[model samples]
Target: MAFFGFKDFDRLSEVDLNIYRFFTANVDKVPYLRVRDIAREAHVSNSSVMRFIHKLGYDSFPEFKVSFRAEQQQAHPTNHQINFVTDQNFPTDIYEKIELVADRMQQADQVIFCAMGSSGALAEYAARQAAAVGFNAICVKDPFYPLVNQLKNTSDNLLIALSVSGKTIELLELLNNFINNEDVTLVAITAEPSSQVALMSRYVLGYSVPQQRIAKYYDLTTQVPALYLTEQLISTARRLAVQAGDHLI
Candidate 1:
C-alpha cells in the first residue's frame, strides 16, 4: 500500500506521500476518478493532485491517467496474457517446467538463489519462500560471495538464477562455475530465455517483460512477470513437499 504511487517514490514529500498512499489504496478507481473526486477522497486540494501529476512529469491529468492505465496493463495482465518460453532444445512447456523444478527441489539438499542489482531482491524473496516450504535456503546477492562452496552443495543443489537481461557478466560467470556440476540443477527466470543464463540452466522460465533502465545503472523493468512465475514455482514446490509428508515451517 505504500510503494506504488509514482516511479520517483524517494523524491516525494510527506504530503505527497500521503497522496501516494491514497493512490495505492484506491488504485483501481484513481485513473477513472476526476481530480475533484481524488482531492475529496484524499482530503487534499485539487491543486495538490495537479502538483502530484506534474511532479511525476505529466503535462496534465489526462496524460498521467493514460500512462497509469498502461502501467496497470503491464502490472496486472490477464491470465491468458501470461506467457513463458524456453530454449528449443528443452521444450517441456511452462507448467511442466514448474513441475521439473519442483522435482529437483524434492531431491535437492540445498536451495541457493543467485542474483545481483535489482534482481537481488527477487532472489531473496524466492529464497525465503523456498525455506518456508522446507528446503535449506541460501541467498547469494554479492557476485563474489565465496563461490567455491556454493558451486556444489553436499552433492545435491538447485540454483535459481534471476536477471532481467540474462547478460550480467559476473552472474553468468558464477553460473558457468556450476554449469558443469552433475549434482547441481540450475534454473533461470529471465526476460531473455535464449541468453547464456538460460543456455546454462537445466530449466528456463522466460517472460516477455519490456526491459527498462534509468539514467545509467538502474533497471526499471517491471518484475511483475518474473515475480508471478517464481511464486508459482515455490507454491508448486510447497504442494509437492506436502504430498510427500514433509513438515513445512
Candidate 2:
C-alpha cells in the first residue's frame, strides 16, 4: 500500500498542475466533482479535465474520487494512543517513555511530524526516519498550505505535532483545520493535555519537562522531551516495517 517513488504525477504539465490546484482549493465544495464543474473551476474544457484525470491514473471522475478516498484511508489508520506528560521534572524512566512512543507510531499509517523552535528539529528527525523506512511521511512547518495540499492527494496521513506549552498559534491553526476534516488523523505531542493543541488533536502524547523562555532564542528546556519522543517514534516505525517486510529506504 506504499506509494514510494511513484512519479506518475511528477511529469505533470503546467496545465495539469493548475487543474490540480483548482480541485484542491475546492475539495470541500466538490466532494465528487463533475467534469463540467472541474472544467469551470480550472477554466479548461471538459475534454482537458478528462484527459488530466486519465493522466493522474483515473479511468473516470467517479472512479478517481473512489480511489482518492481509498488512498486517504490507507494512508491514515485509526488505531492510536495518547500520552499526557504533566511532570515538571525530567523523565526518569527512559525505557517506559520510549516504549509508549513506539506503541503509538506502530498504529499510525503515516506521520505528519511538526514542531516549533527546538521541537521542530525533533519533528524533522522523526519524519526522516519514517521516510527512510518507506513510510509515507511528511514534515510540516510554518508555511502549511503546501503540506495541506499534499495531504489532500494522499490517504491515511497521520499528523504528529509537537509543542511544549501546547499553545503555539501556527500549530493550533493547522490542527484546527485537520480537526474539522474527519478524514484526517491528528496526534499531538505536548506537555499539557489541556492546552489548545491537545484539545484539537485526536490523540495527545504528553511529556513532563521544564518550560523556559528566551528573549531572542528558541526555548530548549521544553524541547528535550519532544526530541526523545520523536526518536522513539522513528525507532518504532522502523521495527514495525521490518516485521511487515516493508523495510523503508
Candidate 3:
C-alpha cells in the first residue's frame, strides 16, 4: 500500500504554507514556473525557497515541480472510475439520449466547447468530434471573453460547458451574462446535480459519481466520467447525421 503523510506540511511555517498554496493554485497556469517567480510571489529569497523545497523532500525546484505534478496525476489517474454497460440494458433509453444529443447538434450551425483545468480536455474532445462532423466547432480557451463576444450577436450556435464543480468563476460569470439571452442555447455537463451551472443551463446533463472521503485529494471521479458520456453523445450525433444522408465532411 502507498500513502502520503502531511505531518511535514503541517510543520511548515506560515510563510512556507503561503508559498505552497501559491504553487498549488498556479501550477496549471505556470507548469514550468521558475523558482524566482515562487520566491517573488511568496516575498521570500531564492535561497529560502530552495531550502523550503529541499525540506519538502525535493532535490531541486524543477524536481519539486515534477514530483508535485506526478503526485497530482497519481491522485487523479486518467481512468479513475469504472463505467458499466450491460448488453441486457434497453436500447430505447440509449437511443433517446443519443437522439437528444444528436438533435442539439443538428440545430446548431456553430458550437463552442468551454472548460478549464482537467475538464478542459473533455471540452476539447467534444470540439474535435463536432468538427469531424463538419460542424463549425471551436474550442475556446478563454471562456469569459469568447463567450461574451459570441453571445453579443449569437448565431445558430450552442455553448457546451464541462465543469466538475460548476462553480468556476470564469464559467459562472459567462453563464450569468447569458442567462437572459434567448438567442443562444447553453448546455452544461457537470458532476454536481445542484451546481449553479446545472441550474442556469437551458439543458443540463448530470454525470453522477461517488463522493470521495479524503480531503485535499484530486478525484477523477468528479470529471473523468464525463469523458464516456461526451464520447457517446458525439458518436450518436455522427451516426445519426450519416444515416440521414447528410454527409459530414
Candidates' C-alpha lDDT: 0.82, 0.70, 0.70
Q: Per-residue lDDT of 84-186 in model 2, one digit per residue for the tens? A: 3434433456456545555556665666887776677778787887787677777876646566676676666678888888888877777776776655777
**Superposed model 3: Cα runs more than 4 Å off:** 1-95, 211-219
For candidate 3, the per-residue lDDT at 23 reads 69
Clashing residue pairs for model 3: none
Ranking by lDDT: 1, 3, 2
lDDT of 3 by residue, 1-249 (tens): 111233566657777777777766775644467888778877888887787777787676777766777766776667644445332222335456556766887667778888876788778888988787687888865764656765577666777788878777778887677677776678877877589997888776666665453454454555556776677777777777777787786
RMSD of each: 13.3, 21.7, 12.6
Per the 3 Å backbone cut-off, how many clashing residue pairs does candidate 1 have? Answer: 0
Q: Give the TM-score of candidate 1.
A: 0.63
Q: How far off is residue 137 in model 3, in Å?
A: 1.0
- Model 1 misplacement above 4 A: 1-92, 150-153
